[model samples]
Target: MTATAIVLLVATALSSLVPVIVRRRLRSTLVVDAVTTAVMVGFAATAAALAADAAPARGVGVVVVACAAMIAAVGGGGYVVRLVLWAGGADTRERARDSATGDGEHVPDAESESGTEAEAGPLRGGRVIGYLERAAVAATLLAGWPEGLAVILAVKSLARYPELRAPHAGEQFIMGTFASVLWATAMAGVGFLITH
Candidate 1:
């Protein structure tokens, strides 16, 4: 691989690990976020420079690998956000209980606290949904289909509207989605610069 391609690949690999490091509490979220953003911006700049130099045949392979790396980074970043929130006392169950009871007290049962058994279960399939969502975003952007992002957002919002009524769920959804989309977009932008 060319030196530029090697650097881009290494940067991408390292960016994918920032979230995991933050999740492990080896670094604070603020520091991780700044580092991640800087790394992504550097990736984009490097890709742009590579593109200007006339992409080689291997650029296609690099683009594909970079795209996949972006998706992984986005997913990992979202999980990191969840970890930070949990560490910051933003536990979903606690928020739900507090909202239901109008006070921050632990309630033993969901039904007793919220008068609804449906709310008791875990937020099912959220992790899977987040992965798929970020993948779709990266794919659409890389495919030059920016308009598709609207459809993805619309579908996600509609599907999660009911659950969003809870303050904690809403907060989690917003924060997680924002982080996921931002990472995906940055990754895709880098890929675009390299490929086109």
Candidate 2:
């Protein structure tokens, strides 16, 4: 790798670390804190890839088109997987333990406290939206948007604070690992396309 590539790689790695460090230091959720880091890593990876590739400008154009197509396919695939998972009755958030208290119980409905019947959740709609969200997220990596993608993931991680806060250490580690790998792939993918 060239000096610039090395620098970009280092920068991407460091960016990925920022959210985890911030969350840990703040005693807060890893999800939110790490979003920005992931996005930056993606961007850095793209830049590094572009720098490393000796392709001519015309070749760059072709790469761009190819990368876009690949990203779309990956994003679509992720959505399809999510949809299938949803159709199979896979979501179990209702059974998930409350992260805050480790209480294996659902929070009482707000309407019940108001002496009214509880409302139904939009579970199906939520599942569809979740798939769309993942598609968008995964697509960002495949597109020439690794940095932006990382940021998006970091934001998601932050938003998912409720899901992760007070998680078992093993759970948190697993999540971190997954996030790292995903972001790294995005960076590497975009970079490879840009450079080649």
Candidate 3:
């Protein structure tokens, strides 16, 4: 790998990791969101600066950069989705937990604060779903099988169909899923860039 590729790879890795560290270190969603935005911008600037270097990474450098891109796809989507949700005024907070069940499931509804597994709460478990969705999307793209995106979308839409009827659920689902898939595909593109 050229020095530019190394720098770009490092930038990609930072993009993948900095938000997670900032989110854990800071309590302010605003600040963490700001950092996420900044990291993305920084990554773009770094990539642009080195974009002229069309030399693909070789051997271990390819593996390392690809891994960084995968991490960005899987882990970075949370920040992207969170930022979108926050900007759109969606309630990004997890629903109130049920004390009775000892599980972390959301409080079901007005009728039941105790939260049975059957009830669909707003944006419940969305974080994990987003992560998994992005992971799958990233993996498929990185594997050179773009058709996996259709399967991923179909599965998610079908699975989320029941909960889509709830208030704000459809909006959140669409926004989050769009942000997530975009982020994953973009990161996968970044990974591809490392090869060319």
Clashing pairs in 3: none
Q: Put down candidate 3 lDDT per residue, 27-140, tens digits, no spaces.
A: 354567667766875774566446446687789877776677777777777777777887887765422333434564443343233433333347567767888998899889
Predicted structure 1, TM vs. truth: 0.59
Off by over 4 Å in 1: 1-3, 14-75, 83-89, 92-124
Q: Rank the candidates by lDDT, best first.
A: 3, 1, 2
- The C-alpha TM-scores of every prediction are 0.59, 0.30, 0.78
Stretches of model 3 off by over 4 angstroms after superposition: 19-21, 94-121
In model 2, the worst 10-residue window by lDDT is: 119-128
lDDT of 2 by residue, 73-139 (tens): 2332222333233333443233222442476434543443585533222222332334344455545
Ranking by TM-score: 3, 1, 2
The model with the greatest lDDT is 3
> Whose TM-score is higher: candidate 1's or candidate 2's?
1
| Better structure of 2 and 3 per TM-score | 3
True-vs-predicted CA distance for residue 182, candidate 2, Å:
4.9
Could you tell me the lDDT of residue 46 within candidate 3?
67
